[model samples]
Target: MLKKLCLALALLVMPLPFVATAHAQGQSLNDILEPVRKEVGLPALAAAVIKDGRIIASGAVGTRVLGRDIPVTIDDRFHIGSDTKAMTATLAGMLVDEGKLRWDSTIGEVLGADLPGIDPTFAKITLEQLLSHTSGIPTDTKAIYEQYVDGKAYEETLSQSRLRMLRAFGKNPLKVDPNPTFHYANLGYVAAGAMIEKVAGETWEELIRRRLFDPLELKTAGLGPQATRGKFDAPVGHDVDDKGKITPRPWGPGADVPAGLGPAGVAHMSILDFARWAGWNAGEGKRGPALVKPETLKRIHRQHVTMTLENPPPGTPKSGGYGLGWGIAASPWSDNRPVLGHNGSNTMNLATIMVDPQRDIGIVVTTNFPGPKADEALQSLVRTLYQRFAK
Candidate 1:
């Protein structure tokens, strides 16, 4: 009887064919992300991949605070920077859907007496042109930041002052004819946000919360650090100085939030919350409650204008194209896979969010540090993740 029991135990201990199968199927998402993790010096990263309106995989790596060793969770929030533009564009599309505005309506028609020194030519600029950044208006955020926003409250006086500056300089002809060619300008989105306020009769933040965030149940997503303060964990922002040491910057609210520039940059969110946003875009207006109609999202994703490498504009790589508020890049891992997404950078942080709509796959990465090579590292990590999942 003992010999017979021993023989049965040996048989049970022997590996079954399904063991290898299960091992292969259960390979961790971290397996693919680890390489990029080491290369990028990302102290913390939270990411999720969606497929068919479901979160197939989600995880976090490294630390939320560098020296604290507080591990990052999927809900850790980060400054998404220009990805805010996508949210702003969605809001604009919703306004269009609600009949509050038209794509062809001129900026002057909406802004009316608020903007001074009105150029008649610019008065004819359409909402579509502003959304696509063909309004011929230069991005004045840098100058505005240096001159007015450093430590002061952005009041109506400063807003009017900037408008005067824009009117004075906006007389130059457009770099490319509107609607058929792309030229990214942050001022265009700033103008779009202003239009939202003017037409909706509410502050931009209140309108966004009522029309966009509340409807989608994105309780934690907002235009500035104060919105999420004490409600979620946030990462510190950093930049490498000339001496190559990582220096920390004061983490505070972004001035662009209240200045009607929410459409260009200045959004705050967590990876999990942003994943829900990606799911909505990837699913084509099917995920969560519908903020904008399917037709509106389709218009947002359509390649309304072509971007050329020879004359790449601000806030974009020479190799990428602009579509509405998002960036379009050719996917390296698939045959003719055109990925739609955006990359964002501020003084102390860098971020990228990409989605392959056909495959229903998306990646969201945020880092606290900024350097010359950070964007390149982000692009490379995106490529690596695509290769891993594509196979």
Candidate 2:
């Protein structure tokens, strides 16, 4: 179907208008997410809402297999795709707080002369520029981009393995250089992850487990396919064919994204845990174990660059900007200004998390199936949640 067209369909593709301002029916979160799952034909779907650092409402609906009778649970994991960017950026901030790295530290400075074939210009790229996707790194080009989706083992250390992909981009001139407009660059995040590897002197996976996941207690969080290694205990991602018949594909090499691209996305967890992280961010560092200082989290959420969507991608906002890891926009139904949320997918799944920092509330939704239909379903569900719960 539409999912097989390209890796990601960038627009929301509004299927119909939503009753965003409708009063809550005292309906459970399951009541809200289940119908959307059925109507959209997603293999499985999950959602949760967090207020004041706690999950107040959460649920899941549908089956692991699209046409089968296997049921899913609230604990079933779903890949959150690029939504992982925010978490990676946060981990980087922790290192910065410890003075292990600086926001302005250059890749050249971090890797030193040890990395081979890196151009002088690329070496000059900084943490802020890289994280913000304005460091002159091009959005992963098609050939280079596939390197991430395949889950290839990049050889040695995390930084060295990931940096091999950057040699292709090292000397490439930027579309716009020196603090240009926002461009979604997956490679840029990988580059940043490399810097993290050097500073932490550990694999990105180890650092995430020790520094973030362990502290936050994101029990369901992991890298790659949500499906367990040998079984369909979790929902398996599907690949839709030309005639629209979805093939249920279990977790395998093709299902995993390259670890080098982990900083850009490739994270999977239950909807509840995803919302927990969002809620922590919603508190703006005031709650949830104080992962970073309040101002640091605020800086992460602040609008750093604006995006113009005159003739935008399919899923892009009509008019909006981007913060460090979030797309900054306003909601008509909620009093939430700069409604902070992001849509994530790996061409086989779709997920979203919306946080209203003003009310210290966050909402997250996910679908095991991907494409335009998934986007339409998630955008509608998010609208319902914010309209019903936004302060």
Candidate 3:
């Protein structure tokens, strides 16, 4: 396994923008990406670069499955995994702008009634704390398995199940000081999603679809596995075994993380649409359906906590400042201007987004296969993109 690196780019320069070489201008995105995909042994790879809120270049290459001839098109959707966190955080910002929520909104203020016996300390965790992963909720553990993973809670609504999680986990003493300690916890985002659900009276999925996706015109955006049921209409995720065998997990409940954790991550879309989202962020509400104030959007992009992990799990940040849903860091290649980014994976696929607001440029990369090779592939592709486009 590759040593865990700072951010996606950190693994490759510590880790985006434009000016293609004379020859690069003649090259299609497929021309740029195919060899890297082959070198990395990925089933498929896709990428897009955006400038001033539009995709300037994008492409998808390789097959939908490893041992198949079916090819993937630029329109094929890929699972974004934890990159969904930034979307969830942005959705929260929308609510905050509407006065339905606040950055400082506390758990007790939102869900204390629902969770009557909640620990006072846990209840004090705020919306900002939750989204920033500073809420001190323990990371996945045995208790999480017993209360959530094992039960699956198929009978309960997504919101209902999240509430169940809040009730069960809220009673425990927090794992760290809720203020400064940074522990990346998906459960915190789930709790924040539940809080949004409580105030909005809609499931997180429904609210995001209407409030965020519809307004942004992200038509291909959806929850769960990116591929349609029983059809490889999109790139299917691949699981790599220790022996290096790749198995296609095209579609199913088992293909993704729990539905209750959708708030934490689990969004997918076409590479172009993904670029649209990143470009919107890079524009900082400069153009919009005006989802949130530019200032509010800035708040979401601004780092809230310092990440000190020497070795983070694959596809997450190793070192950087984490904002509500974004990772803020200066790459070795970026000349010290902090860039906003995040990588997502479900152990079957990996997706990455990097935005350079100062340059009004954003880069996104995705692969149907997940692992060190995929990370390295993205790192190389992103570096190539920056070298070609950011001039």
Candidate 4:
């Protein structure tokens, strides 16, 4: 395994811009990625760098799963957690653009009788507030399982009850005042999904597929359980032990889907498909129809709410700031350049998406191991890669 990793790293460093047009424009895509492959214990990883509307470099390393010899490919799908939030936010922006919804429109208007005890303050909560994390909704743990726990009859019941519980709790009022301070709330996105359904007359899944994925030609991007069961080069989630042995386990999609929270997380895709998204965000390429006009995309990236340096989740790096659905962090190795993206982790998966618009470069790193060092490794890799390729 070490030998294969080393060889892959060596190839990543070689200068082949002429023959390997993928590495053109002085970009050493792989040279900086070696540490990520070595430190994360990832069985497989793939990344693509886009520059000036073209795929300048793209490659994959390692195996698709531990103990299997299958090589990872750019097309191999992987779970992309909170990165899904940006897509959800984009969908909301599109609706706003269509005059179907307003950024300052109240959630009570969208949810109506479904959310019975909603505080009057919630009536002032806007679609933009939810997208920007200013809605002040509690990040409900039970609500998460209620929406995503997959199964049959009982699962559905639990889901509805959780939604009801959330509504009941809302009568007390938001933990923080609405529409100002930045509070990262997954449930807020769930509410946004519900709003999309109420106004569009379709489920969140259907709206996302029609509005974002289909147009982008992101064939591999979709909801979890269904996509995992389908025939595709999908990477399996794994738990890595202290000694680095990968152990396979079952972590079926949770109940976030039924709770109308699929917007915050639950989307899955391959590096290639995700690269297309990064490309679009970086103004490098076009997908299908513009999901939102370029102006809308700019609005999505703007810092809508301020988060104190002290507010990041307990273990998150001190350098990062909450921005809309994504996190903004200063690139330590690039004279503190700003990098925009999101990092996602659950019990079975770890993922990061780092995009530098100034350089028109993006990197995504994912691992099945939910280990202590996974996030640190990913952050380090992002800085290392930027130093290597960005002038």
Candidate 5:
């Protein structure tokens, strides 16, 4: 709600009749996105507007990499960093639907036999807390890097590495005493992913592809780096230097946030496919391939914890309710009704999605860039689309 007024400002500047005419005539989303992309100096930007379970408007604009002539298309894949958490959570929900797990399923109950040395406190942590970021797991960048990059975690299998991470971090004392305090941590998702994969007898990567991607028909979706190693087949994520220069990271281990963290983030797909996922979530089980029961899906969207940010960091909500992989907040554009939203970034690329189940509307925006400018550009575009579409 902090920047809700920006949408109001956008309303004042962008005339209603013009937007109505453009929508009626099936105007290219490029017309609306190009100016914003230029204004923000993003390498590339893609977005789609989903209304009533259909992509009513969609577009991709700008170059594949900044300072290059190679252009991007609507089909180009873009990395959606932590937004992958929702998919992982959804996978857990699927397991729950199949009677493989439960929301109250504890780490000890699921993994204690495997990890005999797990901390007693950590052993009691529930799947719900892990998904909601209320499991007392603090953000530990050092632990992640030590395990994934600097250490030998990458050499082992993904599931093995995650187990190692759980063993290592579980020994530490809880970050918060009460157990339900909100402390966003990628590690929590990693642990949750481990539990899901263990119960399902597959890796998180395979589970996501089979359980979520294939079922949702998100053909463009994939794990790890979006672009191919040698070819610019997709829009590569760009890194902004201290001098404001942008560099595209297309290949190598550095392209993604470590394969082991797949359960937490490191997913990429075309904007339309991403919009399809958003649209399905917006449908709130009304329309679906029935990935999970409608009540179960609704439970995932329900707020589990309240996140109160005193001085919100870049790309974070000022204050909102966080559900399983979703930021449940009131969208001013939607008359302040609670909407499911989330922003994902790995400091190179950014992706944001907002789903209004009540309205059956979803807006997804992604760019081959990150930081304040990209965030503002996407937010503005979302507001613009909400103004034109959400009828």
Candidate 6:
């Protein structure tokens, strides 16, 4: 387990961007984030709230990278990591609406022709299983390594490698049998993406870009690293060393956890656009971009089963269940109903989204650093936003 250290006092080193909280409240969203960015020692932090398919508040603060003068802006893209999972699941739901796929479609049924040598047991894995993280897929493997570590992406396309990995995975026993127990697995999503390709004849990335990003009009949305190639278009991810030194990383193959793992993560966009996306989810398909029906959204957000963390961190549920792409937990702040949201990280950047459909409020936050510090900071950030905006 990683140790927790509160560095909120690090605000002392940060330049005073505002004279007081009153200024932050009356000023741009960036002003509100300035203090939190400083307190968390973040190179950059961006956040927003959305209600009824519209962004209500959004802000960005700090520099694009450590030791650089390039300031973070609300329009700049920020990596959202595993938060992309919700979008992928939403895509699957759209396909379901089109009669191209079913929630219970089995992995072997969809891709069996492409892989004849796969294990018979894997044939039973269903789309619902994959989306809900109940698939019997192992959480780790060499292919998983390649998906995250650019040096190991190998020579094959992400989908191709994932297919091969699936075959290899089929040969081995499942990590956990499909049922209600939740076991987070990136490969499960990769497999889900492969199934999407088999049915739609397009890569997961291409599908997401066309179906979701295009229609949503998310101007800042893009795949791969948040930063532009060879340029600081936005905040680049940062890696904090054990010595507490923060190093800015450039855009590269290793810039993200795994570009090939697009189905699981690897999406970035502006905080405002992110808020729009979350707000759409909060609408549960009643809003425009009517990509999926309300019922389908219901199925996606419906809790599948409880999940157990071996070493649960403070403030997180020891046994939380997951829906298609979001974590389902009852927070005291929610007035006793479950909230839907997720956290994403590629080991260098972190983003989180928490939404309450009952209250029609959604909150999102991103930081340019990864690890326990970023997680702790963002957790507090989301709670603050939710408490403020959720009525």
> What lDDT does model 2 reach?
0.74
TM-score of model 4 (CA atoms): 0.80
The better candidate by TM-score, 1 or 3, is 3
lDDT measured at residue 336 in model 5 versus the true structure, 0 to 100: 73
- For model 1, where is the 10-residue window of minimal lDDT? 2-11
What lDDT tens digits, residue by residue, belong to model 6 across residues 157-211? Answer: 7777767767766666554543466667787888898898889988888899999
- Per-prediction TM-score to the true structure, in the order listed: 0.80, 0.89, 0.92, 0.80, 0.92, 0.89
How much RMSD separates candidate 1 from the native structure? Answer: 12.3
Residue 154 C-alpha lDDT in model 2: 37
Please identify model 3 stretches exceeding 4 Å from their true place: 1-7, 11-27, 176-179, 314-317
Compute the lDDT for candidate 3. 0.80
Determine which window of 10 residues in candidate 6 has minimal summed lDDT. Answer: 3-12
| Superposed Cα RMSD, model 3 | 3.8
Q: Which stretches of candidate 4 lie over 4 Å from their true place?
A: 1-35, 140-168, 176-179, 225-227, 230-232, 240-247, 250-260, 284-288, 309-315
Deviating ranges (above 4 Å) for candidate 5 = 1-27
Model 1 alpha-carbon drift over 4 Å, by segment: 1-28, 31-35, 139-181, 226-232, 253-260, 310-317
Residues 10-94 of candidate 4 have per-residue lDDT tens digits of 0012223322433332233454444467666666565565555456566556665667776766667776667788888888888
For residues 1-391, write the lDDT of model 1, one tens digit per residue. Answer: 0000000000001111111112211223454444556677766655555556666555557665556666765556776777877787888888899899998987789876776656677777788888876676654545533432433344454345345444544554445453455555666776777777678877667777788777766667866542233432566566555687865443444312333345567676776677677777887777658778888887887766656655432334566556677777664454556678787656566677777777777766666655545555555555555555534
TM-score of 1: 0.80
Clashes of each: 0, 5, 9, 9, 0, 1
**What ranking of all candidate models by lDDT puts the best one first?**
3, 5, 6, 2, 4, 1
Model 1 residue 65 lDDT score: 54
In the range 1-391, model 3's lDDT, one tens digit per residue, is 1111123544343213233433312224887678778887888999988887767778789999898999998778988888888888888998998899999999999888899899888999999999988888866666664665646578888888998988988888775662587777778888999999888888999988998889988889998888889898988888667897767998876677777888988889998888889888888878888988888988998888998786676545567798988888776667777888888887788888888888888889998888877887886677677656665
